[model samples]
Target: VASWAMISNFIDVVKEGRGTFSIQGLGDPSGRGRMISFVKAPARGGDKEAKKPAIIAGTKTDLRRLSMGKAEAILKTLGVPAEEIKLLTRWNRINLIQRLSTAAAADGSKLGDRYGGFA
Candidate 1:
């Protein structure tokens, strides 16, 4: 079982950072995989809010390499194992902002189909 401290640490790291990002997975039938890219979101709430947001574009590889790819790279850099990620099945949000906006376009360099069709 995972410890609460580990989970709390992950949350704290994300809270202190500012940016948009993505993680794409690709692999073959054997489950060997590679991740394309993990773009970070643009800096927000600063002196200039007009700057283009930071977004992870995509990289391509065989589906089999998905697990070993970009998403895994992110985890490795965070000193966590790839298998520790738990997929999100639902979302319930509470925010103070009354109106917010999300970027609708993904960078052309990224793959459209594999990563939720952001592009």
Candidate 2:
């Protein structure tokens, strides 16, 4: 929930026009698994009130690993400009366990920062 909140807030900031976007998530596990969400930012006040689809993707059922490729795909699907989307991951208890179990456990690439900008 924390990571998703951060991502959603970030997306809201970069989407440009206010009150022009809607955000949603798919594959979210409610209370059990990881939370994933999509941010849809479209131009406002069109000829008609066109509804845009909300793109969705999320972590696997285990909630320990998140695929950057999948995350990128979801952002693309939601029409997020490539240069304006940032990715942030926060580890919960399950993630810590998974990281410790791996023999090659010293990789700190994904742990680079708590906040980053895709721009």
Candidate 3:
């Protein structure tokens, strides 16, 4: 089912050269979760912009919590340098927040006035 598909994708990503990955939720408070690892793909190709790494954000309560460990192991097995593996614990939700703000603004109504917050 969906699990199988995700596993397949993970394998494919590992086989590919130089990709960034982010794992989330090893441990955190506030019930907000945290990022566990940041895998930086090796430098390849001439295009600097193309070198942008991939991100795999995970949360503590996520169903696939074990994925973080699995991903790290696989990357290591593939001979990815140790320096490429970094542990991080931040969730980047700016995109979502910006989208919500944009939508609210587009409605031509002030958020505080419409939602009854501090003016």
Candidate 4:
């Protein structure tokens, strides 16, 4: 979807634009990965069933410089629901990102329990 591409492009831009600097001033809230990524559950018993969906890391940091208008336009093109985009483009989208990451973690955790953990 366009939304996924938007994220991917943002990542590429960050990596291409000398994004090699990180600071501890962000503290424990910035632990581990600097960006969000998805990981799927392992296959069920000899690959009979399809792999589970992936979850995104909530604590990701987007280093790309995106304006509100660009973000709105991008989300509109991506077909994201109006309400969801409203949250996503709001003053920083902290609430939505937090909720998304938490949901992803919870979903991944459930999948892990069901599938006996990821590789």
Candidate 5:
């Protein structure tokens, strides 16, 4: 439940349009970065939301694995620009993850300062 709350708080921050959860400098040789992203992806909703805890607690997925459907849902959720959404979604670029993950992680005040971004 703790992990769920932390992730949910992060999601709430992104939903508020306060900040973004970047992925540029987030990845690494270890896997904490992956944990953050792993948790972030499931937080998007639908069937994914239910398995958020297991996803975070269990195995880790590829750092660069994300579907087109997820891209559209994220762009729409985070309020990304309309024209750019198509291009970004088509390419499934890293910037989209950067903007999205940070958006998910930021919590307005401190998290906003540390992880908040839309670029």
Candidate 6:
């Protein structure tokens, strides 16, 4: 399957919860069969009633691979509001950078150019 298609499937799994699914016609030129299993992380603190916000974050290459339009569309199909999608994307990017910075500091290694000079 195309990279974008795989990404879309993953996003769907994240938004709609885990289940067994199939992605046929992938990994072969002849369009053979393929099955995929999606297992979501268990709820933290064993609080089944707890709610978690779904936020998508990725590296620059990942972001480039999955365009904002496609990402927004995927989220919209899952019932996310357009305005919240914008805010979520922005917040996720910022949080990603902050986490990277924190990890770099803890490890005593510079983030370097991999993060677009975010070090």
Candidate 5 lDDT tens digits, 33-72: 5534312222333454444433422325332455776656
How far out, in Å, is residue 49 in model 6? 50
* Model 6 misplaced stretches (Cα beyond 4 Å): 1-64, 90-119
For residue 98, what is the lDDT in candidate 3? 29
Per-residue lDDT for 40-97 in model 1, tens only?
3235534665665444334233222234344444334434443443331112010100
Q: Cα miss at 94, model 5 (Å)?
A: 3.6
RMSD of 4: 23.6
**CA RMSD for every model?**
28.1, 23.9, 27.0, 23.6, 24.4, 20.6
lDDT of 6 by residue, 1-119 (tens): 56676566667667665532343333223454433433223335346785644333433333334456665654454345777778766446444444554455466653433343332
Instruction: Tell me how far the alpha carbon of residue 37 in candidate 4 is from the true structure, in angstroms, after superposition.
Output: 58
**What is candidate 3's local distance difference test score?**
0.38
Q: Write the per-residue lDDT of candidate 3 for residues 24-103, one digit (tens) a residue.
A: 33222223555423333334544666553433342122222324454344334434454553342112122222234345
Residue-level lDDT for 60 in candidate 4: 30
Error of 2 at 84 (Å): 1.0
Work out the TM-score per prediction. 0.16, 0.20, 0.18, 0.24, 0.32, 0.23
Worst 10 residues of 6 by lDDT: 19-28
User: Which ranges in model 2 have alpha carbons more than 4 Å from their true place?
Assistant: 1-64, 86-119
Off by over 4 Å in 4: 1-80, 87-89, 109-119
Put down candidate 2 lDDT per residue, 1-119, tens digits, no spaces.
47786466556656643432244333334544455334344455345866654322222233324465555443444345656444334333223323332312243333222111111
By the TM-score metric, which is better: model 5 or model 6? 5
Consecutive 10-residue window with the lowest summed lDDT within model 1: 92-101
With candidate 2 superimposed using the best TM-score fit, by how many Å does residue 79's alpha carbon deviate from the native? 1.3
**Clash pairs detected, candidate 5:** 20-102, 20-103, 20-117, 21-101, 21-102, 21-103, 22-98, 22-102, 23-98
Output the better candidate (2/3) by lDDT. Answer: 2
Candidate 3 segments whose C-alpha is farther than 4 A from its true place: 1-66, 87-119
Better of 1 and 5 by lDDT: 5
Task: Please report, as a residue range, the 10-residue window in candidate 4 with the lowest summed lDDT.
Answer: 19-28
Which sections of candidate 1 miss by over 4 Å?
1-51, 54-68, 86-119
How far in Å is the alpha carbon of 20 misplaced in model 2? 61
